[model samples]
Target: MIARSTFSNGIVLCCRSDDDDSLLAVKCIDIDECPTSSLVLLQHEVALTRTISHENIHTYSSVWLSKSRLCMSSLFMDYGSCADIISSHFKHGLPEKIMALILYEILTALSYLRSVNLIHRGVRCSHILVSKNGEIKLSGHRNMIELSRDGIPVKKVHDFPKHDSSMLPWLSPEILQQDMQGYCTKSDIYSLGITACELANGYAPFTDMPSTQMLLEKLNGTIPFMLDETTVAPLIEDTSPSANADTEKFKSEMIEAAKSRKFSTAMHQLVTDCLERDPDMRMDADQLLKHPVFRQIKGLSKCQILQPVFEKMDPISKKASARVFQEQEEMMDELNRMSMCDVEWDFQE
Candidate 1:
């Protein structure tokens, strides 16, 4: 038992024990206010969390049901959610290297969850938590949707409402149409794609619109929002024009490079693949982890570019000494060639 404070519809408390030391985030609901089926879904979430064991996921500690409140406990992350991280250090956007690491960790976590046939129906920055050392843990597991033996969503009382696709803007197109027959692991990929876009843009796509309007726009095939070199300059100029200039330059170069690198094409392709109008084209978590982009990033680590996931990778994946040496040489040559030319930008920072 520890100190407790109450908030709307729930209570927050500090819980400490020899076996557990973490913050307890408990949401209380009147049994009568919430549907009985919803209560069952909550219990299912607790069971699912209790079964999963992963470093990148918050550990489920305990669940308590008293007369009126349902309390759930999990490991406490000192740092706040990814929403906090994005708002703090990555307001404009994060460096490509750091972004790659974050995406890799997220993919890893999604892979583990998918292995058990669970789809984190809600995948967003707010649902991710970062530890003190920058390791990411996918929290809010209670929101995941369990799948049937055929990999389709189980028709549960808490499942998405038939007419509502407005809750999560990042959901796959298939989900929006109420196409339960087509929903599968690929749906999570669509959410991940949106998450990537959010990571790069510093906000949710089309965040300016109301939820209903956003959903309508998405259903009508509107392209989701993104921040490019020109877009980034305006938002970040006050902080450091020079750094923004460099970032914009890098973005332009990276876009060109992606065009040629089949695996490293703009993030849009991967995102769009996950958001395919036809669900058949979407990629699963395992397939995404094995993408050429991941392989290209493996090459980046060898150049002594200390990105986030590089340190956590298995030694075998990190062994690119020969390739790294060659890449460095080529990079130097490219830099030397560019030094002789004058570059002008149409967009002002």
Candidate 2:
């Protein structure tokens, strides 16, 4: 008999499974309690996970309905999540190499998803799972949106509830504005950039401010808590007065090395690119994978790892992607044009 631990949303412990065994995370979803639309979305996620099997992407083990509960099958990750790591080690950021490896794995997974026309709408650091062996897996595939269904153009669903803008400052402006067509592979890239920032700082950008205030600031084109001389100095300086000046200089150099304009090594650049007011200029997963920083990572693979749960097309997702895509394109174009004009106008003013 399997022992159950916690229960919520129809999800409970089926058996006394430790973190070691090759068991799966089984969520018992209640179709009756959940919106019919959401149930369909959950099924799609299961199908998608099962279809795509890769080292970087979380594997879906099985799916079954028992009585009134819909059970989902997913690989159980023992190391918890990236968020857990950050919270535990908030005093010091992770090593650059380790961070690089994590990002590379995520990018690889995203590339595979994009290749199959899937978009992981949620790519935050918390969503990333690390194995005991340091391998990374991108979990939370339930939020992914498929671009095409069968041969016919699928209708996109735009009625999903809006998420709090504060929780994810790294999200593309298009997504925040609810432009479904404008949301694309690029949206995930933006989230990835934010995740990188979180990894480096051990805190979400603009974490000090209220979400409402942060949202307004972001809308105004100002990024909160960007690393400047003051912030960088304190973060690097050793408290010991006996510390050598040369060591200090080296520390400064290390911080500088982490800075960039291309979303390569510098979390700042990635933030800039992904959070650019314009979506058109934002880099997609393929473009991001080609970046020098991502290219140099070792043990990275180019193979497609995961597949969709349902081979059959969902009309809601297709329509949503197209609508969000077009809206995002227009918004981006406008934002870019306005930014250029502002730069020139500021000089004149």
**lDDT tens readout by residue for model 1, 1-349:** 2223221234444444555453444444565566665667567677878888887777567677787777676655544566666666556454555556667778888898878777777778877765545567787565576777455645321246332233367776667666446576667777877877777666667665677787687777765534564334434444434346766775455344333322235454566555555556667777777765554467453224333323333221123344567789999999888943588657866
For this target, which candidate reaches the highest lDDT against the unseen true structure? 1
User: How do the residues 107-138 of candidate 2 rate in per-residue lDDT, one tens digit apiece?
Assistant: 88988887777778778877787644456799
Candidate 1 contains a number of clashing pairs equal to 0
Top candidate, metric TM-score: 1
Q: Local error of candidate 2 at 137, Å?
A: 1.1
Model 2 whole-model lDDT (C-alpha atoms): 0.60
TM-score of each: 0.63, 0.63
Q: Backbone collision count in every prediction?
A: 0, 27
Q: What are the runs in model 2 whose C-alpha is more than 4 Å off? A: 1-21, 30-40, 148-170, 179-181, 206-212, 224-268, 295-349
